[model samples]
Target: MASYASKQLLSIAIIFFCALGHLTSAQIVTLEVKEGNSTCIKAELVARFSVAYNTTNGTRTVTFPFPGNATVGNRSSCGGTELPPLLAASFGDGHALILRFSINGSQYRVESLALEYNLNDSSIFPNSSSPSLVTVKTDSAGILAQINTTYRCESSWPVSLGGGSGNASGNASVTFSNMRLQAYMLGSDLSRNETVCTADQSVTTVAPKTSPVTPAPVPTVPGNPERGNYNVTNNNGTICLMAYMGLQLNLTYPSSVQNKTVQEVVNLQPNQTKSSGSCEVSNATLQLRDDRTNLTFSFTLNTTSNKYHLSGISITATWPDMKEPFSASNGSLDYLRGTLGRSYLCSAEQTLVVDQTFAINTFHLQVQPFGVNGGQFEAAEECQLDEDNMLIPIIVGAALAGLVLIVLIAYLIGRKRSHAGYQTI
Candidate 1:
């Protein structure tokens, strides 16, 4: 009977330990940010103090909150309570990913993950298995830099079917009406060369047993005059991609010009046009991908007047992303130097809210960049500054001036007629 009791006690103790062990083996998810190229970034998530193969779906569901107080925006797949779809997909991958995160409010589709784990854990038990930690790292610096330095222009490209994947090309002329146009042309060069060729004996009527006849050298096509690539610099540090409303992308190229020249010419333009020549691109979108942000933009560009208007730009990025959209305006004016400056006037702070149907996590961003340059009114093009409210002040000023002029004219005419009547009487 005593022996039976001892066995029962031992079994209960074993069960208790098993339950305790499971609880103690739970893993914690943590993340780190690493830097990368301007276009993309690397984000790292580390599952710490974990037992092998013990960290799965349930364990991962724990929210690893990021400290960046980004404006939590839209993520279409699930409700705002759950992980955004793109972040979920990127994180759901077997390995840790250096994926797009969010900045302020933006979203992206997560793609690949590279994960690592340590394999040494024996402190808890005398004969226990070794434990490892899973770490993920990505580039936040790269993302911020990309946002700061990058350029954006949207155009519809004409699509062609002759190529395997099909080809698309278009050129929408972008006129920098108010913007300064500075150009430099490189001189074209030409050279001559001589070569010899041997004729086939079968084709030539060779004297019986004579050597093969030498053929005239073929002429080489001369290299066409090519333009050098231009470099655009913001002399005042205020010029930005979003400032111009009359901006259109030019992609068409003349057949005679070499492709190198074509690249050089457009490369020098104030805003780089994505594709080249007479072809115009419509229904185009802008995509900004990086470790901290994945931003997708959809907008329109007018064909005839070379005007660009942004419809909307949406983004899908990391979870816990947040922002309050705000608008501010500041301009520069140098009377002595005649240097025009710009200012920014943004709308009141508004949170970004995304519809939850696209099945992908996304964030959002919007800007016009008029304030970045000094004077919206004095910009080269009339519509370069597109503030609906700015027109009100101008209308009121015109009305007030007209009213003053009418009152003065009535006074002057009444006085003149009275003086004339008195003289006549």
Candidate 2:
């Protein structure tokens, strides 16, 4: 009886700890991508939804709880080397969500995302047909980032798909939030590594000193730039590079064009037209310009080994007192090195010093340097910063495992000693 009691206690302890661990982890569901009978990608996702529907007198909104156990249905276009890979999921009661992806050259993007919920199935809309649900595509919540990278950010931002159509028409008024996704996994099992996003970076939000009522002095160091997804596509609708960063350029140009040097800051961002960057099989470019400055970043593709990197940078600037715009070029620097169809990630700030004249800093940066395939980030090369960030969890997990092992060993020895004094009577 004593031995049996000890064994039972050991089992109970293990179960209790496991349950506690599960409760502490994020509420996410697992998804698998099968490629030719092999499970190529495994992911965990957490999605929540808010939807609007018609009523007898007016309209109403319903917010859904954390989506649990949503499965990718048969119509999903996974396991292909195609332009886009899609995941379609249908929850119970005719509620569904679909995610579309685009991969080109060196980047991947969320092409489209839609949420569907049947008004008839929802208890709030009692007198509706079974197929009365509408679908809404989010116009702004598209996540543009690298291919084959782990994306992590705890967001409460509401991403509206649309349907404010205001017409009594059966259009979807849908939104989603608290989205956590790890997709295009390199191995069958999902990895816990995460690439930092620009949204998670510190912003330069120092309000300008204006009113006399303001007491504190304004800060001199600028905060982070607004990070966003920037891409370029070819005339053939093929992608070249997909970059995500809050990009800022620092130039130490001669203040008088004769030799007195000082700092000049330029921001690189997407424009209204041709906002999607440009790409080719051999190389890609991201460009932004102002009235006096033109800046371009060039990435080179390695076809033989199927890899790519940020290889070159060029700028044209016309400062005051200078008659002609000065030109600067730097090539053969490997910044974000990554495999084709994969991404490169750096959580910490990165600086590329082209020369004393100019330097580039990228924050909250995750990029698919080249060779995006199947509209999915399937593999990744982590920057030293991200790798180091990932290591912390690993080290902590190892310590926890060691502690568990020690307790297990102690229990085993106790059980063995108890058994020594008795036989299988």
lDDT (CA) for every model shown?
A: 0.24, 0.57
Error of 1 at 51 (Å): 66
Tens digit of lDDT per residue, candidate 2, span 143-257? 5433455554443233335432222333232322234454565676544444433233223453322223222222233566668776666687666566677777666544454
Give the runs in model 2 whose Cα sits over 4 Å from its true position.
Answer: 1-220, 256-260, 264-278, 319-326, 373-379, 411-425
- State the lDDT of candidate 1 residue by residue for 1-425, as single tens digits: 33444455456556655655543332323222211211122222222211112232311111121222221122212212343222221232122222333323211222222222232323321232323434432121111111111111111111001101101111111111111100010111111111111111112333212112212111221222122221111435432323221111112112232312120001112233221111124333334344433444343444542333333434443322123221111111000001122222222111111221111111111232222234222333211113222444665576557556655665565566556656744
Q: Count the backbone clashes (under 3 Å) in each candidate.
A: 70, 18
Model 1 stretches astray by more than 4 angstroms: 1-292, 298-314, 321-387
The alpha-carbon deviation from the true structure for residue 366 of candidate 1, after best TM-score superposition, in angstroms, is 10
Per-prediction TM-score: 0.21, 0.42
